[model samples]
Target: MSEVLPQFRLLQPGTAEEAIAAKLASPSARVCAGGTDLMVAMRRGLVETDTLIDLAGIEEMTAIEVNADGLHIGAGVNLRRIAGSSLIAKDCPAVAQAALTVAGPTHREVATVGGNLCLDTRCLYYNQSDSWRKANDFCLKYRGDTCHVAPTGNRCRAAYSGDLAPALMVHRAEIEIAGPDGRRRVALQDFYREDGADHLALDPTEIVTGVHVPPSDIASAYAKLRIRSAIDFPLAGVAVACEITAASAHRFSIAVTGTNSRPVLFEAPDPLTGDDDPDVFFAGLNKLVQKSVSPQRTTTTAAHHRRLSVAALASRLARKLSAA
Candidate 1:
């Protein structure tokens, strides 16, 4: 049987201020940009809200500008635009590459960058339709007492499955958020919590306004392990960004996603000195990545497989960065 989205009121706000006001009035109201994740959650009964504040009409949130500081991507800018942007490709290839891997062409046209960053965590047991969920009690993310993924667990173990977040984290992106009090910026890496139910570090009235990626002469790459080439969430993903000089790599940052409740970032203690043997450097990097993550059975893939996939991807990306 086909599932239908529950009835709800849609509120399209023309400005960021208006959107915040609407959310402040009704703290339970859900803020939607692309509606890609929200719509699916609504149909599955994973999220329920009487009102949805749409940010599509706000022109300020749709601009992509590259200035002296770096590239500034408005929260409402769609994935299609990001993937096809020549400036982004040259300035931050990892971001462009990551954006191109999100879902498929049609999904990218409607999915906004903010939506991808703020995507809801996923668990095999928590993402089923309403009817299927009812047969075996709801998970911790939905209001039930226990999490099916970890039966005796006290916290939700839904995996963070976004592709853009890890890429942005490697670039050291900062997120701009606006709320009733005022506006503030947070490092993208610090914006997510380990808890799946309350993953974002955002108040009910707050909305992400933009993402800022500072300019740097860095080489970056992104890789992922998924069930299919298109329309499937990644089983594991890795992104690497670093300044590669003739002798060594400096300011190296590696981020892993889709295998844990929250994305993990590993910054090298010091520059990887010496360029004689790239193979040896990548071998150590793979081990470091494998040790950094503690994977659980949150998705269809086995925990060990997810960990190994992340390690392999990290190695592949390291090789690319070394060559660049």
Candidate 2:
């Protein structure tokens, strides 16, 4: 095991404004929420920093509330809070379900929903130690210029591993960010990019304040495939949300994670019925899902297998919601 270095200084900010000021003053400083991911990266020498800004001490950023408009989950809200809340389970089952898949009890206790959404993309080759990577010339996601997952590719092929991001995207959630310039909001779907290196679109100086989940009568579900029942990133995950109306009209949003650079939200046709059979709506949706996700090869698992299973995952979840 690598020894913990003692050179860094810690700053505990009591408010969101203070945290923002502290971060801006030390641009290279690492922000610590629950420290679940940051601590692991620091211990493994994957992250190098001179200062740490602890956001956990900020009072306003830890609030979680449901109102007449929607749900507002503060950035510092922990995974355990999301998982154990009756309001979360009742109002946003998809988000709750995604939270349930995040690691184990200790991990959940120390991990935050915002941290999970902003997690660093992962790859087997890039996730290794400096010594291990140097021995293999490194990969595109690390030091080498070429992507080991796809040698001829021009971009890093690191896979996203978040469990909550997809669920949020499918729900059409909005993100609230604060910086020196003040606060601004954007669709959660627009907050990410399709490239591993610049996955998040937020400015370096911006700190996510909270996430707003809009009110909807839509039904939703989240499903994930992983090697274990706990404490593992999904090999492939899917989230589906749609509305069922009096006119029998159907409007849907689907997002996939753990298989691409960022979550992809695609629209499927209304009624979603097909000529083959009434049940063929799901069959067609399964096909649509497969066509929408273009998963590239990565160092974790077989890219093709993960990509192909996304549609099935979505189809299964959609069927379950339809029955409910």
Candidate 3:
């Protein structure tokens, strides 16, 4: 990592409209909510920007409101607030739990919801220092022609390791975006694509303003497997949301991260009619994730290891939540 930080002109916008105007004025400028990820990438030489549009001064982006409809969280709200929110904790347990597990305490204090959602795809080969990447001939994500992870393929294999996306996916969330054209809402899952090099479908002029999760009564939980319990990104993360009543598992929506270019949301299977065997139910889930999750050699850990862990974490969370 470079010891010195890169210098850039920063633009502070007081409102979302102003922020959008600033971005329009500077097409190459990046919209920054919290600098947790952006600053690091800037210092690492992964990102080169002449201007940064900071959203910290936008008051509406920091607001978090819960009502009868559900939770409406602004993009700039810190993860710490979401992790400790009573409303979010009760109605959307998985969302709160995922927020609590992001990096460490200090990181959560500044990392914003928007930043996490729009996090850049990561890979061991691509996230190294400038000199290190140069010596290795850089990867397809940056300035190279071939992807180091899969030389034969044209697609970048970097993983989308964000924690909150999968959790929010299980709750059926929608993202609100503001751009040069106007404002629009899209399902959270639709906001991402399969390509790691350019996973988000956001236009250059667009800015994610907030996330809206409709009211839900399902019991949900999140669990992740990482090299370290804190500070490290997940090797594989799973979020399970189940609709259960009278102590029997009926329906489930499972989502996985860190194993794919974008978080994969598995479609819920046939409703368990209270007589389905636990072993059979879980076995099917394992097959579902293994068949759909195509984990490449992105991390130091073996590809198969992440695949198995993704299955295990999903099963564990499903079992626990199904019994809730």
Candidate 4:
């Protein structure tokens, strides 16, 4: 643990209802599932909560079950369990692969699926110790008025670098949120905002309770680019899901992440169909991805490198899908 953690009260709730009640009572409370991301933000002084509502004790939020409709994953379900779950592996290999790419083995064991989906957007200027940020004026993501990434912009330009989000977006997953207003279901694709400072559409009083992934017959794959194979966020990545019938491809959905404030879903130039040559498909995909993804200067990696990585990953995923 870092030495810069702020003082706060911890509340362990046995059920999601209790947790929501506690959060409503505190108003400024933050929810903690695995504390994988929350703890890091606290240590960096990016998050200062007066109370933390721990949801780990809620058994219902940790169950993984397959139902007649599809798979139901509790928000508290950890990444290691998702990666190892036979149900998820058989039904949604893209999601399983994305889960496997999060951090490393140790982090996967502690990071929950909900936590990953609700990950805080990252920026070079925002995620730092108080002393480090104080040396220079803070960014818009924090208390400062100016955004270091885009000084002319009024909103924060932090990047959403989570690997699982793009994969889940391809699946058309739905998020279940519980709060004082009652429960509501939101399409995962519509759950995120483009602004990094307020990334999730979730209200402050709400906490994600579970995720629902509908069953599908589509073939899918996830490819990520990072500085290292372990413990590093993706510099650029792509997730693809599509269906092929009678030697023609249909229902194509391609999502690109780690390059912008929100994951960008690429629209095919035209309906992609037929057993097209891998080279042809790759060329088309490369062009579309390169045009769609515009990497910012937030990370240490060069923007051009990130753009190239996205194109390369998309090409690889297209080849893999064609081969399948």
Per TM-score, the best of the predicted structures is 3
Colliding residue pairs in candidate 3 = none
The C-alpha TM-scores of every prediction are: 0.96, 0.94, 0.97, 0.95
lDDT of each: 0.86, 0.81, 0.89, 0.83
Tens-digit lDDT string for candidate 1 (85-156): 999888888889999998999999989988988899888888888888777777778857778878888888
Error of 1 at 40 (Å): 0.7
Per-residue lDDT of model 4, residues 1-324, tens digit only: 254778999999998889988977888899998898899889888888889988889999888888788888999999999889878877878889989989989988889988988998888887787878887777778888888878898987788988888888788889999888788888887888888888889888788999998888877889898899877898887898776755565546788888888887765655456655657767887888898876888888888999988888877776777667
User: Candidate 2 on 1-324: residue-level lDDT in tens?
Assistant: 353653689999888788888888888888878888777777666778889988888788889998898999998898999989888888778899999899999998879877988888887777776677777887776557777777887887677889898888877899889888999989998988888877998887788888999988878889888888767888889889877867665666788988778887887775643233536788888888888876766645677788778888888888777667
Clashes of each: 0, 0, 0, 0
lDDT of 4: 0.83
Candidate 4 off by > 4 Å: 245-247, 269-271, 275-277
Residue 186, candidate 3: how far off, in angstroms?
Answer: 0.5
**Candidate 3 segments exceeding 4 Å error:** 1-3, 245-249
lDDT of 3: 0.89
Best by lDDT: 3
Q: How far off is residue 33 in model 2, in Å?
A: 1.0
